[model samples]
Target: MEKRFNKIVTLFAGLGLLVSCVSENKIEETFGVKKLVDNCVEKTILTINGLTDADSLPRNILQGQAEWNKVGIHDWTSGFWPGILWYAYEASGDSTILSNARKFTEPLYGVLDVPVDNHDLGFMLNCSFGNGYRLTKDSAYHDFLLVAADSLATLFNPKVGTILSWPAMGEKMGWPHNTIIDNMINLELLFWASKNGGSHDLYDMAVRHAETCMNTLVRPDYTIYHVAVFDTINGHFIKGVTHQGYSDNSMWTRGQGWGIYGYTMVYRETGNEKFLDLAEKLADKFIERLPEDGIPYWDFDCPSIPNAPKDASAAAVAASAMLELSTFMKSEELTTKYKDAAVSLLTRLSSDDYSSKDKNKAMLMHSTGHYPNGSEIDASIIYADYYYIEALTRLKKINEGRRL
Candidate 1:
């Protein structure tokens, strides 16, 4: 046991060294943000292009494009990569990137518009159609978004006041009565639809569901449960379980990050003091436990495992959330602190060791998808890349106004 503990200590110490090295070499070169964004856009486009071949799909980290041909075009996960590409293109204003994103995403128009009862409509249409609207100001994207929103609203259960997770994956692995922290992201699309589509019912339903989640799923300490099982008949909370984390009560880092940002967004949309309060509370807990380098382990309170590593993706996601929270706050000092922390985290990630220049890797590094179940760890994830770019974009816009 002593030997194992020593190994864990050594691993953390090595990671601490990497953090120090990155901080020492923080790149202050002009246009560094733009360059990183451009690199991510270019690499992601190439990755999508490569996945067109069957042999390359399994090896492809992002959703494998070759799966599209075999499984047909409606695959949900396949849309996320191109969706992110569209987002990056919109942010950077590169016509080529936009063109590539359209080429990759246009096929999904038929699939997303087909009235499917999937939980991932937000994942599919929001990133693609939503981004297309943001980029091109095309009414078609808005129309698709409203259509998808209407389809999503069909999943809402009046008893639970939340969207059902999926149709019925089956009894053994079923989550029909389950609500997850990740679903908070999907609610954003509902909020958007409510505003733009002129549906007060949609808006009210989204708010009520968000309130239900806050009451049941979020702990007093601000750590979030991965899933909450509700008694549909009684309209009461039954129990909490970890669908993705290590255990029932473990604080999954990314899930917490989702809560942090999701609540802030809710506050933004509704002007609800409770949502803002929850966002601040969750942010406090998250920042308090983060390592000195700003990244966190997959679970905040988990026992360390050999070869299991920290997740920079969670850090990147939380940093973006912090920036959002900073803007919402009235205190200048607090805002500056949050902004500085975000910049520090992103600067560390952009270092040579973490941010791979190779087109194949395509992300700022040290992302862990799932550690307890032995999934991708210390690897580049698409969401990590997405949030990393989002952070940089936020920083660039802020710095531009401040002018050093």
Candidate 2:
């Protein structure tokens, strides 16, 4: 049903383009969308090729070490690097980029068949195989995504009303049921799976998990908790806490970005007005608190304030989400506001101060990953680049008279 609906929308979009006589070049000239995308692709190719002569690609560039770090397929972030390569190929039609994307994506096949904990299977599979299927319409890619969606659904707890994020590895910190804001990004895989002929149960699990997140993690002011613990046995809410933020009550910048992205996605899949409202509220809160550069600090409540490290990754994620959210909005005022805010944020990320000087390194800098653990602080993270490219693609689609 969803597929049929999308086909109709596509038909109408094509008719509209024909009627308006809007060529791709005209749209690109008006928005400079293709120019920005071309720049990103050039930077990505240079950075990726420069990272290694070996088969492995860099997960991230460690600025202090002046080297790139690689991770295995099971790693939470393994999918994004290849996913970026696919995007590059899509934009440029470069045969070398396509070959590299295929090579990098081949290693990720293990993720579909293996058992893994953590809620990032969506990130792992969706970015790689998800994009692969979208572009090539390969049956193998579709089958793998189905397998991965089933694998991800195994973590969902009916009692807890959410997918368990972390396993009970540590007695002090790990609970039987723990959900994180990052899990929200994974739900897209579930929704796609169900709509594409997977189980209705997977779709139901996603909706329930989203509702539980909104109830437990989202605060009145639109800030979000990094973690939500539940008593799985009794189906009771235990506590809200922070593992990566400044403190338990403080707002982690990336968590807020996840909220904005996640809820906007829910609105997209479900057409729920309340979810759209929540996404817009979170976007406003995030934009309202931005520093002068339109980027965000590592944590909203960080004591360093003006001295805190900027998280260009969070800004990228939120900007991308806002762009998509704007497409669903009915009010012209809200749409323009969100669109302008996303443009401002992306402009900051593309500026000389935030963008890497050397084309052979990470593109956008100043990302904070696991700050409380003292890992990847103020460095360029892979997922940041992924979302930045995604945002640009979305904007380009919008300008070309298409849906986001």
For each candidate in turn, the TM-score is 0.83, 0.91
Worst 10-residue stretch by lDDT in candidate 1? 54-63
Q: After best superposition, candidate 1 residue 353: deviation in angstroms?
A: 3.3
lDDT of 1 at 291: 76
lDDT of 1 by residue, 147-259 (tens): 77888888888898887765563255554477788778788788899989647788887898899999888987889998887776866788778866878998998999889
Quickly count the clashes in candidate 2: 0
RMSD of each: 13.1, 6.9
Q: What's model 1's TM-score?
A: 0.83
Candidate 2 local Cα displacement, residue 237, angstroms = 0.9
Native-vs-model 2 lDDT? Answer: 0.86
Residue pairs of candidate 2 with colliding backbone atoms: none
